[model samples]
Target: MSEKSSDTSGRPESSPESGDGAEAAPGSTPAAVSGAARVSPGRANAAATKPARASTAPVPPQDTGPDVPKVPAYLQTQPRPDVWLGKGPQPPGLLSRLRTPSPPAIGPATLWSVFATALLSALLLGDGLGPNLLIVAVPAALGAFFAARSAGRVLRPWTAVWAVGGMALLAVPALREAGWPVFLAVVSALALGSLALHGSRSWPGVLLGSLGLFPSVAGGVRWGWRGVRDRAGDSRGRVRTVVRSAAVAAVLLIVFGTLFASADAAFADLLGRLTPDVSVGDSPWRLFLFVLGAAGALAAAYSAAAPVRWDGITVRPGKARNRAEWAVPLIVLDLLFAAFIALQLVVLLGGYDKVREETGLLPAEYARQGFWQLLWATVLTLLVIALALRWAPRGGPRDRTLVRSVLGTLCVLTLVVVASALRRMDLYVDAFGLTRLRISVAAVELWLGVVLVLIIAAGVLGARMLPRAIAASAAIGVLAFGLLSPDGLIAEQNVARYDRDKRIDIEYLESLSADAVPALDTLPEPLRSCALEHFRRDLARQDTPWYASSWGEVRARDILERTPVQNHGSDCYGLGQEADERGGDEEEHSYDPY
Candidate 1:
């Protein structure tokens, strides 16, 4: 990757002979290249024969962005380095043809096929505003399949693992609400995996490739658009014929069908049935919108599956000239961590009572403190460890030992903090009640804990495969979690809590979407009836459209099993005699799930 160097700054550099057939020289500053041999006679004659300049006045230099590239050493030898320097007759002025931008290249056909798959999956997952895990997983799984299929020349095992793993993470929404954070995790992990799989030599390349998923997809779309434009002259193309025919047929059908429908009642009825009732709001807006949405999705899916070349984008740790330089700083850092660890141990032994006493706060308030901050601290510490290793000076065994010992110690200590955080959260939850955010954070902290364990195995124990193991574990964990069902878990936990403590909040349970109904069914007696009554009223009140009945909606609908009128005790769920008495003072009717 480091074989050739034209510029240290991230810019496109130019050489006098860059466009010429002349061999390239080593990349260096103008001063370093002053000693190179002069240009040959043929080049001189060609330059001499070039057309006269369009303007006699001196052309002002243009400044590119701040990270400007230095002119190649060879450029200094030329009287006018930016002038045309090729073998053939040239255009006048200093513009080098090499800087001409080329259009982005579209992905292989297989990639487009994958995008189509994602589009279909998106449609199947949901219709309107709510989040859908199925949508995330559908595209994710397809993206993984295609990523593996098109991963460039350098394929790492972790790449495939991460791609597949990322897809699994996307599946998390199937269990819980598909929050934006989960989507972020899905995209980032998938991008990282794809970049790693492509054997990106530099971290910058990995980052650019990952973040560029959207841009590249958009670029791919541009490329495809241009490609279509370029072939605009192709009158015989199948696409042209299809479009022309479809347009003509649409017009003819509209005109004649309108007339026919006006003239004949039976024929009009048949034609009306043929016309789809689908619309955004009594118009064809949703259809047009779906078309645009499908196009964007198609482009994104294809773009992600196919990445652009980013070989030059690289960033690496700067190794020190001597190992001794890293010694003192590393040792000092280790001591600080050691001290911190000692303090943490003391605190751990201090017992919950001491924390409660010192903090002078209730269990809920106390639990909230230190947990989030400590979690962030552990994350930053990992990043620090990474940075120290990356920018490390050459080190002897002692340095590695110190680094490893410190890292191992930190990992162990962080686990202590993680445990503390979990205990704190549990205490808080017990004192109060569970919420989506609380439960979700608990899962996230546990996942982070798993990540720390993998870091320990990789950093201290030198278990090379553990990083891949970590990725795999994360993906598998989310997938398993999703399959177990997050909404169901939350519902179960809160319901169980209510059972244990008699703190059921019927109104809050009622507010949850039907997704929570199946789990809420496990609730006993009046509470169960109370929760289901809301569903009973709403389900009976509004009709589900055929087109909008996604798998989630379908599942929730299935839980009703039967109409409320089928059974005598089917009195809509209630709150003992309170709700029953409120509802026309009816007797506290018996409630049965049956």
Candidate 2:
């Protein structure tokens, strides 16, 4: 009871005094508050002896619980508690980092990488890497690597190293055979590396590459739809823009298709007319046509479709702008230009004459002839442009006044034909190998040229549905000219050969012309006799097999006879030196550098 009374009395002594009473007398110091209680043990008993103050002061609040942990001021509101638990680095938030983009940790030496790729491609292209692994594969592999690496910046160095190494490794088998197992292992590694390192912050490259691939896979599926709508005159929204674009595309298709059809027809006729005839070599023009049909359809479809959506995959929209849209058409024009020129050179350079000599046998020729063709096509195209300004029909106002478009397209086609005719004329007078009959043939060739020009003018000027009208006309031209070939009617045939081991088999040859019989007596027995008889028959006109024209001819035969066989008697051979030696992957077969 006494202790309880003292405890209560002590509160009065510890309380702060206000007035000049006995408890508030001089010499008393205010007690210090410690921790949370605000009353120390030292001041409590002294406070008990004094009287309480009369003023109504509120009682102080007590904080009696055990100490609780406190976060530091700097980290008080941080989102991750674990960040505070450990001293290691933490990734920044997604949104915050993107707002302020940063440069690389180490500035890239992009030029050095480009130089390395180029240097390596050149080495592989020079036959520094031999047979078994071909020079053509370099571009394909390099292209794939470039395309894959364009997806992400992070894998640039890794991709560069692998691309270079893979190219170098491809030459290993050529330098010295590593057998099939090793080849398979290397190929597998290439595929895996391609998949793993493919990354990109910018989606523009990927989108374009995919679009480029689509036309090849889908064929004319999309083109057929667009062609229909294009003819319907449904121009709305950007109406003028729509009409102008469709007109340009249609004109190009018409011009190229007609020129190509005419050339094909003329060449077939030239081959047929050659007396003491020879078999013609393989025509890359045919393969090019197939590729064109496919690529054209795709390009047409892409042009018709609205631009692709660019949302999650990119940081910006329209980064590449409409460049691809414009670029594809120009590229198509250039490719067609090249094809047109090549067909011309084939006619002038005695492709028909060679076919007569090698009839019923594959004639060996590469599209290296494309260079000369490209040159002639350019020259003739300029001439045709000048002529079209004087002759093309005026466009109606609803057609967007596309007089330039129509004229330009017509000019390009005319130039290809005119240039082809000139090339044929030059061949007739060449003292190195001319006959009087060849001169007569040249006169016929001139008349045919005039007819072709007339047909082309009619097709362009008369047609309302330009692209399809031109396509149907081209198909008609091919069948018609093909039937009138000078070699007489084409027939199925075969070439008999005695292999190195002295076994004989009838190797199938595609087609033969009836006029080729006179050339058979010139060759050595077996191969000579076989080649002679085949030549006499003109068996080189079939269009089915892709490589048929290149088989068993002088260049191919000589190279094959000299080349060391691999994969146990396979017919694969090395491609000649490449155009640019410095831009491809060397190791993989399907690599593409562009």
Candidate 3:
């Protein structure tokens, strides 16, 4: 509370009145002025800075209940205006008032950057499916993070870290085609998490994120209705001259334009070119999808950029927490997992041969046998741990110690299972070569381990949202693997193996998406041509424009151009193309986006 007033000489001055809040009255303080400069009477700009007067009307003090906590002045929420006037965050030029009837919801600079990215995204999508879409996700994700930052919410340090990883994951198209639902789930979790706080799981924020799907639709309809109602009720208001002038101009243009077009063939051609190519009778679903996508994208982008207040949505901590109730299940689960780990250790050390003998399977089959089961077990184990963490009791005598020990033990056992799953997957891939399923499982397993480590941290960190952070980080970390081009990576590794030791499975390689196109550069002869042929056929079918070109798309396009058409027949797929009847399958299975 400070005070300032003008002296007889018309220079502004601050009085030594304390706690009266006579600080240049109120809102008329020079916005750019700071520190002692604002009250400097002798300053040249002092005359321009008109002091605001306090309103004569009194504001009643708000009643906070006795139990309600006093918020710190700095932490106290501010009243946000529905609209902002004045030059905004721009240089006040001569035409500022005329040009800016209302500024964009976000600032112009932010909007321009976002618009550029969105346009790039639209152009890429026009070219059909490829790394172009994945690549576009980067700018979108970055834009979202920037938006969140600008929204001015106080964020946890780790939130930014995991968000970056999540954004990287969304760019990888290969993760989508991964056989398991795990990859998609991970991506979705990370995306939603970028919007949610680990603190409360922000159920209201979650609800709001869902609202982003149709924010423009709902907001526009509501706002439009209000505007119409206001206009109808306002008795003293004149019909807006600008609107009337536009109507008159439109009428004149229609009449004169039609008469001119009717009179001249050249004018008719010019009118035809000038007219917009609008579809009057578009399909309902197509229009619906387009609107939904546009609105959802905009809403999501806005929400990300300028987050709403979420403190109201936070979960209240419970007082009568039963630590033993939480500890029992965790201890029991850890014991069960610990025993299983013991059995796994035995199997790893020579006992695997005995189990194989009983199963009557070959060495490769033996290694494959437990891999999927172990992978599934590891996934389920993490789910259990997450649930336990979510439901864990708070603030009991020795509760932290007991819960931490139990959760840590369970995590350790889970890591062991993750390790076993990876070992088995490695053995299987080595024996039978790579497939989408195997590679995806290995990735899932690796991520499961990462999640477990984060889980261990959650137990140790003892923060409220640590479980959520664990889940978020796990999802983000594994999906981030997609950025490495899992399909292309697998293709390259397998191709190199084939070239080195003649261990190629051309059928499997041919089944991969266009992501593998560039990696086929070193593959020998017929198989390479066959794969290129399929990719080329796919390219010919695509409508990929120049703007959205990706490395995979461009490489595949180049390879087909360079390779002789004669070498690209069924002969490259060899006798297996005949035996498996995969010729038709390749046509169906090629890189066609849904």
Candidate 4:
């Protein structure tokens, strides 16, 4: 072969007939020879000797045309090993995830269940909450259950328990007339039920799942629309045919029915009564209720069918600190708590007389003075303990012993504070009869005591289940509070206080809901009549439909019906006229001392 001519840059120039100064092999082209020249001799010999192994490394695309510029190495995209192995693409960002395709279609039974729930909600909830809430909630829960089953998901025992709890909460509006308890119970029930359905075991997971409800509802709507869109193509002809048939039937019925009604006055009257007054004004509200019900039901079913693995979320442990750094502050806190507990003990033991003399406050006033402060202090102590545990030294036995000793002491002392706060509430209640705020706060303080106890117990038993235990305790507390009927209990306590001191606030009694009727009706004569007057007037003027009738209202009406107000003409102890003149601004005489 002739030597190739050298160019000005000292590189070998190509020949017209053959490239790279070499004759093309029998079956190979000049491009092949050039490519071969680019390979190293060692790699070529190795490739010739060994069988080719597939590479996970990405191959750059071949140049398609001479006009195309070569891409830089850094700019070229490379497939990851996972992608090359067909595992799937890497996780995308939030916006990318949101833009992903809709989930697969739900089962026909689940779809119909959603529709039925929506219809029932529109019919029952249009008037407001009552036994009708229970009616709607039961079918919605059952739909979730069946959806889970059909999707091959196993329902944990806790799921059923939470579902039942939610149903009981839904029945609160039907059982109790107090709006606050009903609202709180309903919200707690939804959170608990959502957590249970999603199988969230961690405290953070529970929080995230509860917060995810709105997103889940939106997803449900999207899923429903996608399913409808997918089935529309197949069902279009059938739908059109049905619509035409219905239109024809409606027109024929209208003509013949009108003629028959004109022929008979009784038939016309019956027809008019049977036909519902479907006004345009009410249509929007009914539609809103329907959509709300359908969306909620669909979300529950979708979540149960393919629950997210909220429990799988891992939280990074906080960086460990020196044993002294973690222990010193907690030890100081424990000492402070101890000092407070000692003070409480002294007061409990006979120092009350000295305190009363020095403070110049009545027993109730002294009790109320520091109750809120102690409650907050107890709450802050729990927070300190949690933080201390998080950063506690992960060293040897000495570190663990120090952590347990300091944190356990704090918890014990905080329990004393909780007790003090509760004692103060009790004294205050005795001084000024029980009110909703007092009872509610007292219940919270009681729950805090229980939590402190749980924390102490967790020191002995591993604290793996502490978060869930605390959540369950709170849920159970709320359910029990709702079931106990705080208004009725407040009424009873106030009535008992009146019997003891012969001093009652009739105005306060009148402000209570219908749930307190039975308790208030036990009062003697004019007092009973005055207390029941408001409830009696309300019940008499009210015309609640059966769907919106609560058991609390029914019971109150029955009590008032059996025992009419004896002294209607009496000025309700002169409080009624004052209330009207003040425009219900009787806050100055309110029983809530706090």
Highest TM-score scorer: 4
lDDT of 4 by residue, 1-594 (tens): 123212222332333333222335488775655554343344334444445454455444434467767899999999657645776667875423422243347766677688889988887787656777888877777777777787777867766666667777777788887888888888987887787667766767667765445557777777777766776777898668866998999999999999999999999988865543346789998899899999999888777776765665677778999977778877887787778778777555444465577567665777778888987887887787777777889889888888888888788888888877887777678767798888988999999999999999989787887877787788889888888999999999988877775556787778888999999999987678888888988888876665577788889988988878876575676653443344322432334535
Candidate whose lDDT is highest: 4
The CA-based lDDT of model 3 is what? 0.55
Stretches of candidate 4 exceeding 4 Å from the true structure: 1-104, 231-280, 349-360, 573-593
Of models 1 and 3, which has the larger TM-score?
1
What is residue 527's positional error in candidate 2, in angstroms?
A: 9.3
Error of 2 at 222 (Å): 32
Candidates 2 and 4, the one with greater TM-score: 4
Q: Candidate 2 lDDT, tens digit per residue, 476-580?
A: 333233223222211111111111112212121112222222222222343334333334333333221211122123232333234322231222111111211
TM-score of each: 0.59, 0.23, 0.57, 0.76
What's the number of clashes in each of the models?
A: 4, 44, 3, 0
Q: What tens digits encode model 1's per-residue C-alpha lDDT throughout 170-231?
A: 54444333344345455545555455433343444444544544544454456556544555
In candidate 3 the C-alpha lDDT for residue 577 amounts to 34
The TM-score obtained by model 4 is 0.76
Which residue segments of model 2 deviate by more than 4 Å? 1-39, 43-527, 530-594
lDDT, model 1: 0.55
How much does candidate 2 score in TM-score? 0.23
RMSD of 1: 19.4
